[model samples]
Target: MRIATGGIAQETNTFQREPTTLADFERPGFGVVARGEEILDLEGTGTVYGGVVAEAKALGVELVPTTYGGVMPGGRVARSAFDTLRDEILVALRAALPVDGVLLVLHGAMALEDHDDGEGLLLDAVRDLVGPDVPIVAPLDLHTNLSDAMMAGADAFVGYKEYPHVDMPRTGARALQILAATVRGQARPVMAHARLPLIAPNQSMVTTWQSPLKIAIDRAREIEREPGVLAATVLGGFPFADVPFAGVATIVVTDDDPPLARRLADELATICWDRRAEFAVRPVPVDDAIAEAMAAPPGSVYVLADIADSGASGTAGDGTVILAGLIAAGARSAAVAQIMDREAVAACIAAGVGSTVTLAIGGRHDNLHGPPVRVTGAVRSIHEGGFALAGPMGAGTRSSRGRTVVLEIGGPGGIEVQLTEVRGHPHDLNYFRAFGIEPTERRILVLKSAAHFRAAFEPIATKVIEVDAPGISSANLANFDYRALRRPIHPLDAGARWSPGA
Candidate 1:
């Protein structure tokens, strides 16, 4: 069987000031094509293609590759950019005519200026091109804002089960398996979608231990074991997106079992509503968090999350709330990865390693979080920061820190600070290794992220504490001056109650 594969993935934040452009796609890498006669080793952050190639090799299926484009999460996608990608994929599908099936990896929460349901629009266009008979399987992020149109257009859909998205390979495998089955005439797939009323807070929606998500995931696994059920997905919709379908969703794929799928989806949605309250998170004050961290044991590492400036939520990742707290607390042996300042990086490079120079770090993009903190520190190490993942997420994925420089600051009260220019989150151990800063050796490690840090840091941390810092994706829903979000959603609308059919 010949299978066609491609992807266009990005989680758009409508409120972000910058729009995702064609340049952004090309800058981060864009469009890889690998066909049947080629045996290329797909590595690095090329996760979608990596999994697709792996699955095709295992199944002994001939593969036809198309263009794949992805960008970091940011503002609404430009209309022209969306058109370029959509047209490219549609053209590829038409070119690869009579193909057995199509597999796509999509970030299901994409919002374009002209289209709110970007994934659905792509799927519909593909369905129109391929005709109704061809099986189309898609793997999506768990944070997708699933739409009814998407459910109607695709034959089968699966989403990452883990929030940190450690399950990308598994989701890809499932999509391929379903597609293979459909190609072999072994199964006929139908999809059902359930929209939940509640909107989960980004911080509280961590799937590692939180309720609603935990229960919902467990129930989904249980239902997947039932006959006729091919896949079950619970999408914790992207809250930052202002689209109409912005909320939690439960989707099930089965073979001619619409009734059973609907019943199971409703059951899952009911559980989501029941556990809605548990997903509400109260932010801890930056000063309080610092005090707590400072007072903790010597070996303990405190994780202070500046959620609002979280790179995952389309912020600039330059917030200074936690940095200010650290400065005020006069804590020692603390390390913060990636403040994303070009000027600071240049100065550090010019000054050379071990040179004591005064520099301003953070607060350049977001004034709402706090002003930048001025500190005099020695340039600890300057390197062209590069590291390969040592964990589950593309173990061989190589990421650059973009001319990184680490500044070690000595405060008035003997605190040590390591500031970097890398904008990526402190999600992996490699992030530290890239800078020659060993996290295991530090007394305190501060990461500007929501949750992904747990997978790498949890094992070595004597104790992990999540400090709520200010930025765009804050735990406090009221902090954002939201103009477009639908009313009566959780936390924002305290008295809202939702039933399955309501």
Candidate 2:
């Protein structure tokens, strides 16, 4: 049997003003595009492709690799960029005709300038080419904004159960394994989908032990063990996307058991919806968070989670609310992971290392994040901004922020700030280590990340505090001016209600 695989994956934040262009995908660090045989290089990696390749080999199936393009989560993808990626995948799949099945690696929340359901449309086109008889299975990020077109175009979906997405490869393996079974005539997978009028903030949806999301995920896992059940997935959905279908969703796939699938899907959806109030959590006030960090003992590290400016959720990574707070409090032994300011980076680069430069930093991308703050600091170092992931999440993958310039805020060992030309995820320790900052030695670390940081930072942190700030990815959904999202959503509309058939 032959299984064709590959996809274009991205998680879009519609509130971000910048458009994700073709150049973004072509970039070396944060973006990746693998075609045909080149895709085999991902065989033993931690990505979804790695899982698919390993499973195919074990199942003794010919793996037909198509085109796969994945860029960092950001604003709506430009129409031209989306078309180019989709065409590449379609062209490759067309050449590898008569495949037994297809396994797709997709970030189900991807959106484009002209399309709200990017994965749905891609699946539709692939379904059209492959026909109904060929089973198509996909593994989605846990934050998928499940859409009807997605359900209609694919036979089955398996979403990552972990929030930090540490289980990406496992999710991929499950998807391919299920597809292999269906293609071998051992099982017929039927899927049922249920979407709720609920939008949980990314911070509140962390699947850390006993988290509210974990409770629902555990129940889904329980159902998956039932007879005839193939898989169960619960997607908390990406609220920042501002799409019509931006909410929580559940999918249940069973072997020729439509009734069972629908029952399990509805059960899981209701379980999540019933506990929706728990997901409406508020972060600690910025002042309190800063004060707590300042008071922490000098030996250990304290983490301030700047959720609103989270790069993982598609913010510009230039929010200065927390930075301003830290500076105002005259906090020592503190470090801000990053602030995306091309002008500031350029100025620092021009000033050269060891030279002092005064410039306004951050708050240039979106007004909601806060205005820029002026700072005079010596340029500690300049780097090309490339680093390999040393953590469990995407361990073998490489990432870059494009020309990082470090600035010592007060003095040599005072508050250090990493200013970059591009947005960055400081979830991993290597992000700071690569730029000459030792996370373990620092008393306080300010990170522009929601929950993903916990996977790497929590282990070493004395205390992790979530700080409330203003930005597009803020947990306070009311702050956003969302016009495209479907009305009567929870939290936004207190009267919003949902039932199995409603």
Candidate 3:
């Protein structure tokens, strides 16, 4: 069997002020824009492409690698960037025609500046090109924003069941298996999508623990084990996206059983809705979180999650709210994984290591996150912000945060800040270890991540506290002015209610 694979993946946050451009997608060490044979480089990585390549090799199928562009979650994609990516994928697919099936590796929450449904549009175009006979399948992120167009364009979609998304390769393999079965005439796949009027915070969507989202994911897994069930998944959805479809979704795929798929999808969706209130989160204030950490066992390490400024959730990783609090309290033995500030990094680089420099760091990206905090510190070290993931999530995948510099505020054993020239997701310990900072030795580690960091940092952390810092990606939905989001969403509006087929 011959199968073609590739697509664009990006999680969009409509609340962010900056627009994601082609440059962002093409940024080396950060963004990915692989084409043809270059896609084979992901064969052993823990990514969707890696899974697709592995599965195809195991199945003895001829896999055609096409264009695949992806970047970290950020502001709504620019129309020109989206068009370029979409066109590249289409062109590659056109060249790889006469294939048995197409496997798309997509982040289903992608929103463009001019269109709310970027994934849907791409899927629709692919479907149009493949006609109806050729099977089209995709593996989606757990934060997918299900849309009617997306549903209409694909034969089946397998969403990542885990929130930290350690199962990207697994989801890709599962989706590919379904497509292979269809191509071999072993199964007739039918899928159903159920959208719930709820947008839960990222902190509440962790699947590693016994959370509400975890319960729904467990139920989805159970349903997948039943007869005729091909795949099932519960998406917590990306609330930062202000699109109409920004809410939780349940997707079910069955072997020629549309009714069963719909029933199971609706059942899972209802389960999430019933536990909606449990998904709401109230992060502790920055000062209180720091105090709590200080009160802990003397040598134990604590991970203070700065969720609001999570680059993984599309905020510019430059919020200084927590930094301000730490500095104000003269917090010692604390290391901030990162604060994205090009100007600060440049100043530190020019100052040279060991030189004392006073500058304003962070809060230059967006007005919604926090203002810059001025501080005088010695330039500790400077290095290129690039590292390979050594964690469960996206392990083996290379990541970068551009130019980086370490600044020690208030002298030795004080708060050490890692300032970067580009935004970053410090989910892995390698992000810190690469800079000569040992996370285990730190008393408190401030990270600009929501939950993905838990995959690597949780086991080492004595305690994890989500800090209530000001940023666009925070649980505080009220901070964002939504103009296109559907009204009466749960948690947003306590009175919001829903029923199947409503």
Candidate 4:
């Protein structure tokens, strides 16, 4: 059987000011470079296509290559850019016709300049090409903003079980398995979808906790053991994407069991509704978080997360709220990662290791988060920051910090700060290992992420704390003047009530 695989993954924040262009997708050492004309072959690296290639090789399936492009999460993708890439992929699929199956590694929450449902449109186009009989399997991020149109087009769907997405390769393998099973006539896939009324805040959706996500996901898994069930998925829909369908969703694929699938989906949705209040996270102010971290017992590492400027949701990781508070509180032995400052990185490189230099860090690109914080620190080390992730979210994928330099700032016991040009979030142990810094060795680890950090860093953290730092992807969704989002959704319209199965 011949299989075709590619990716066009980016979570669009409608309120963001920047446009995700082809150049944004080609960030040096961070994203892939694929133009419309390129027939890129699969090369095993830390990319989506790389993971696809690895899985196809293991399964011994003949693989068809196609262009894969991904930009860091940001504003809407340009209409022309999305059209160009979409047409390129469709043309490739047409050229590679008669393939047994097509597999897509999609972000599932992509928004275009003109359309809110880019993933749905892409799937519809593919369905038009392949006709109804052909099996189309897609592995998606757990934070997918699933739509009814998307569910109608694909044969089956699988999503990352872990939020930090350490399960990319695993999710890919599962998709392949479902395709193999379907081709072998072992199962006939039918999809069922349920849209929950409650939209989870980005920070409160952490899977590590015993919230409704844990219970709902557990129930889904349990129900999957029933007769004719093929796959079960819980989509913690990307709330930042301002589309009408932007909320929590549950999807189930079963073999000739539509009723059972719908029942399962309803069960999961009910669980989400019942636990909606538990999903609300009240973020602590930056000053309070810093004060608590400073007062922690010696040798304990406290984790402070900047939820607003989280790289997971595609916000520029340049918030100054946490940094300002840390400096004000005179916190010591603390470290932050990938501040996304190009000029500061250059200065640190020129100053050389151990040379004292003063520069502004963070808050340059995203003024919405606050002004930049100035710091005087000695350059610790310079390296081409690259490492292979080995955790659940980014396992087996290669990532880079891109011309990274560690700076040691004011602290009696020596506090280190990591700076980089790359704009992606740190999802695994390797994010720290790339800089030769041991996360477990630090007394305080400040990550610019919402929830994905918990999967990889929770094991090492003595205590984890969420800080209300400023950025585009703020947990206080009400702060965003969302003109595009439909009203009467969750906290936005508190007085309005929504019922399940409406």
Tens-place lDDT digits, model 2, residues 82-102: 899889888888999988998
Q: 170 in model 4: Cα distance from truth in Å? A: 2.3
Whole-model alpha-carbon lDDT for candidate 3? 0.90
Q: RMSDs, each prediction?
A: 2.6, 1.0, 1.0, 2.8
RMSD of 2: 1.0
lDDT of each: 0.75, 0.90, 0.90, 0.77
Error of 2 at 421 (Å): 1.2
Tell me the tens digit of each residue's lDDT in model 4 across 1-502.
Answer: 8877665788888777677887776664465556423323433443455566666777788777565677667788888777777787888888888888888768889998889988898888888998988899898888889887888889999876666665676677788788877877888888888887557777766668766676788787787788888888888888777788887888888998898888887777888777777777788988888888888887788889888887768787777778777777777788887688888999899889888998888888857878878999889889887777777554554577678888888843566778887666876767787787888877778888888888888888888888887777777777777666666777677754545456
For residue 230, model 1's alpha carbon misses the true position, in angstroms, by: 0.5
Kindly list the per-residue Cα lDDT of model 1 for residues 1-502, writing each as its tens digit: 9888776788887767778887676652112223233213562233655676777778988777666677767778888888887787778778889899999778899988878888988888888888898889999888899887888888989988886777787788789889998999998888888887667767666777755687788889988999999999898888887777887889888888888888888888888888888878776777887787788877676666666666777766677778777777777877877677778888888999878898788778657556888988888778776666777555555665567777777732244444444466677887787777778877677776777777777777776666677766666666666666667777678767777656
> Residue 291 error for model 2, in Å?
0.5
Measured by TM-score, how close is model 2 to the native structure? 0.98
Better of 1 and 2 by lDDT: 2
> Which of candidates 3 and 4 reaches a greater TM-score?
3
How many residue pairs collide in each prediction? 3, 0, 0, 7
Work out the TM-score per prediction: 0.93, 0.98, 0.99, 0.91
Judged by lDDT against the true structure, how good is candidate 1? 0.75
**Which wins on lDDT, candidate 1 or candidate 4?**
4
| Model 3 error, position 134 (Å) | 0.8
Clashing pairs in 2: none
